[model samples]
Target: MSLTKEAIQLITDTALVATAKALDTDMPTVVIPEGAKVVNLEAYGAFRSRFRGTFSTNSLLDFGKYVTDRAVGDARGFINQDEMTCSVLFNLGTEEAPGHADDRAVLKLKATAGYQAVQAISGRAMSQKDMSDWIEDWNSTLSAVGEDNQNISLVKAIAAVRTITVKASSESDHTVSETRASRSAMDAIEATSKETLPTSLIFSVVPFEGLQLREIILRISVITSGAQPALKLRWVGEEVQREEIAQEFKSVLQDQIGDAAALSLGAFDPK
Candidate 1:
């Protein structure tokens, strides 16, 4: 996060104010003759101005940013993950495709698993990349935090997700990639037949190569009655700006190329 010039000034000013308090408490009282100019609390504007100028020019930009972020983080408070409890499940599976003549298209169904573990950490240390990754799986993680209803904080929500084998029916049954999302996440997707709850606030960005992903929260409810789970494309956005994101997802899903992948999209209901 970029710190504004005003925020930097406030930081310097606050520090200067604290310094003045410490000095007044520890230093001996000074009596200056009339017209004498000794810097004191009365000259706070000047003192703060000079301090801010020096701080702004110094190469402590990183330090300044860290301090500013710390201030903001403290204001946001911390999340106690241990007191929090949640249900968890996530998985990935695939099937074969026989229609395509291309050898690379021999497989019809494919799913790649993500292996990134979720855990709460210092939000002050969170960067843009961190936000992107967290929001990508926010709903699944939230499902893990389901029904806790105890005013979940951002950092806690970010870190609350952990895959539990306790509820997964297909744990380790499908490990297409070296990395895969926790079983809890997969269970979340299957249990609700939706990517996330409607109330979930997800954050995502657009890709230059394809459609802009406006719905930070995405969904792929499946037609559960089928022998194999097929995605419900129309419900991807669940009616939020579906006109834009729905078309974009459909176009991209069609243009995508890979192994053991199915590009099936149609009207289907959950069994």
Candidate 2:
């Protein structure tokens, strides 16, 4: 999405805290300084509160960096640099009438770190289960990367983002998409749930055009279509390759984040 006039009109914010409440999601504690100066503090709730406004991806990343840098300046040494990353949630699918006389093109790009490394390890992309297994292996052993796939490293790629999912749809027939509420990702971000089940879930919204992306995504994701019930991580600036994805957008985000991570708390219902 671009930051054009129409895209600007599509901006919305519902802070993660409120987003959790509206969606009945589990909230996870996100570590941040109590009074860290933030650039977009006011706009944080635009996504869920029906207060549409447009801002670029870079702007959001900068705001996150501001907090991280401020924490360092304040001598708050409780976190790592990776914890400084930011995650943004938005939609790009639409139900434009396909009244055109001709067929149109569609592109869905997702990258899972395990898949890329597997392709590099072998000669082809692995199946979903295999990919999941690969991640499990890494999570437990942390030894999936090596001199395979021409030395393409899943560890390095995932370091940039935990998951990435890119979807473009002019039209879709799934009725669930039309009725499902947007998942309140923040609930997981702020949750301290003692229960084993999910405290929150993902939601949906009307997808519009003219949006912009500066590509600063990091850590965890949710795809709101209820039928699929999927999750994944994305690598910054990496173009997804059908044969050998560049580690850009990955699928089945369950493996990328820890149990306490936001997307993981959703209990990611598998497809």
Candidate 3:
């Protein structure tokens, strides 16, 4: 979010050139006295030099940085604004004992959600501490809901039903977690089984902390798979909850922008 001395100088030079060009076109009747070095837009260079020296000094460093960032964005392009999207990663495992790679889930803002975030961030006037606290609240308040559990922390929610137990007619119950294990377990049970097992899984999701916890129930498809067993997880009926999270996230992003709009999250490169 900072510009180097060399970059500042280059941007200043470019601005000076554009201003000189505009002045030349607008004030063609103005006369440059003979023997004056101000002929050919030299005056603009002098003015730009003095302005750059005054603003780029240590006392006005912040102002200079702001001006430079604005100029760069207007003349070139924004780093994060164009994408209009923000991505969040939810960690399902504890800090010390992290879960598998698949345990992590990513949530990204849709186009409309991103628009709301942009509006919220740009419309707010906040201080640095306020922004920090807002972010903390956003992270800590997120929780998930299940059929049996309500308002459980997102980190503790089960991403998938890792294990299930099924009983055959004459054999003891078999428990399986992986796809291969489920396939093998089903093969042995189907030989004597008359009907497929009726089972459903509960999933909890909190799109944002402090927002509503959503419940998703995915039914196991044992009859459809025949000898093989698969758990396909998908759900509906949480559109309102998702929208509420998006709105709450907008407020958080507003705090993230704080007093300086240039300091917005989109100002940085994802890389």
Candidate 4:
């Protein structure tokens, strides 16, 4: 089934309104701004696959668009306005779609962009010496447990600081690439630190591809204050998720290619 322009516009307007709500900001009233632009407004329709007589197939539909805007300020934006975008996709699948038969729709609103300006703030301040001391403490804790006893010993270290809290400042002018890299770095640090004590780390980022910057927090809770920890990662934003990430990644790839094949690929990916 094909969607009409009016239908598409209505969907776009609703998605845009939803985007504003997710960003916790009001919709633009007058000027569109220098860097601001609506990237795409389109819809998709899915059909069921049944060759036999009147077998009821499924129809899955979605509407999405991205907005890019430049950040204003003196600080360098890690992600340029070129990197930010807004998107909304809804799954119109019904009960026939396997496990989610009863689940009618899955609506998603995401802001994927870059932040060039890094904000400066104060939180739990930890000096280099403090980090060193924590590391030493962790090592000592590990040594207390027999080296041969890996499993339970590791657990013990994790449990030692289940409530040990560390403060971190939000990132300034962060791009998606920079944010991902930062997260990867933190993950590495957590992995190494967990060898001795329970560790918790948090980081925030603003992608240049979208309007809002997303804050991500990761927690590693040591069960029983000594076991190896269980990890939990949370992302706080207007519209940020796995599917949205995938869509944005695909868009970036298409822009980089800018060829016939790339256009074809973009066609398949849509907005």
Candidate 5:
């Protein structure tokens, strides 16, 4: 059956909420470059010829005659010799952000920890049966939440194609860095597995003021490269526009992300 408008709306809402949750959890700080330089070039060129003459016995062959004649001719024509100079300047400006180093460190630590967890899980003896079960459980959860929408279907299809490669070597005794790396890798895979709705839907739910929404959405599109598309929620006069219906969208997204987070953490009871 074709997707109903309500189904579309619900999918968009859930996707946006999930995106917002991701943003809230990882409030990425803005970064500006250290310095910028500008250079300007200006130049002028002119040509001039000079001649020296000594008194000659032959007046006809005199250099002074040639020189004086040309000078007198130019003077009669009111031509004046002049020089021109051009100047250029170079300027630089710096952009400094506060607490950037500390923020980077915290992010690095979180990523490392996540990687380690993934490594540990992968090293464990997990059978094909376990993987199949995991997939089934994930699908069932989505189905139970009325997420049979097109977006969810697409996500499931994509996830089915994903292969979780495990190393034969034991990962039980991993270094702190290795453990963090493992967890980080798994987190990335999990995020990749959930690509249902378009990115526009994600932006619709972001907590941005109306004027700022467009700019932020543009930024997100650039960063994500349209991996997750979102929709625009517009308003006209006193009436709420359907095309701009984002309140419900945000709510649904939040719920979906919460559910996904719980599942990833193994906090959700499958029973």
Candidate 6:
């Protein structure tokens, strides 16, 4: 039988009430002091211990360059120098939000040999008068220009390769730069030179406005998967960083909410 308008309204109201009751039963019950005036009961225990922060696409790239620029003793034009440009990888989805609204940007600082090269060359920018004669002599010996991208040992190993591959059923002949023996040699060189250059950089990162994480170190490691190798910078000491974030949040809360009550970092359990 078709229900009347009043009957349908009654059924809808009953369902809404039942859902509210279920939610209340499942939610944790926050105890209130006796004779306390309760206000906004739904929002009483809404304090969140963990928070998410994101950086804008351009901000991420700039931050990456800033870190490198600082590391190489603030070398002039180091960030944009053709061979020494900071390799910051990131992407903004097709649907980009205007201004700094794009939050999915995660900057990956690809630690390349050029960073070391820049460090090696930055000394040349200073005048000889600014250095002691002995220091200058030592600096001259270390002034040899380093390869922009390739490691010196790896380049030497590949240059020493003598083996060649002869294809029997190939349309065009191709020359193999590094044979298996050379690869083995390169691997040995890489094992020692993997961390020859600075692997991690200590700097500040402002993931959110007015919130700068100072002395946050990001460590990079090389990954050899396919024909081309890649570098990845991963954040370490996450617990410490999180603690700093929590403290910042706690301070802000105390400033506005007053220090009458003690604030702690934790979560609530739903019954």
- Structural similarity to truth (TM-score) of each candidate: 0.18, 0.16, 0.26, 0.20, 0.12, 0.27
Clash count per candidate: 19, 49, 4, 42, 31, 0
lDDT of 5 by residue, 1-271 (tens): 7999878877766665455422222233222222211211112213211222222221112322332333321111110111011010011111352221110000000112222232233324333345335335434222211133234352443243243232222224334673464322221212222323222111122121211122111111111123332212221121232123234333332332232211111111112
Whose TM-score is higher: candidate 1's or candidate 6's?
6
What is the C-alpha lDDT profile of model 2 across 143-186, one tens digit per residue? 22222313323444333223323343343333346559443222
**Against the correct fold, how does model 6 do in TM-score?**
0.27
Tens digits of per-residue lDDT, candidate 3, 17-56, equal: 5554333432232223232124444454534321211122
TM-score of 3: 0.26
Model 1 Cα displacement at 159 (Å)? 2.9
Which pairs of residues have clashing backbones in candidate 6? none
lDDT of 6 by residue, 142-177 (tens): 221123433323223222211112222223334456
Q: After superposition, how far is residue 252 of candidate 4 from its true place, in Å?
A: 1.6
- Against the true structure, candidate 1 has what lDDT? 0.30
TM-score of 5: 0.12
When superposed on Cα atoms, how far off is each prediction in RMSD?
29.0, 31.0, 21.5, 25.5, 39.5, 21.2
Model 1 lDDT tens row, 7-117: 887776666555543334222333343323234554443333121111111112232233333332111111112211111101111125222111111111111121112
Model 5's lDDT to the true fold?
0.25
RMSD value for candidate 5: 39.5
- Best candidate, lDDT-wise? 3
lDDT of 4 by residue, 6-49 (tens): 78777766666555432222322321222334322222214322
Output the number of the TM-score-best candidate: 6
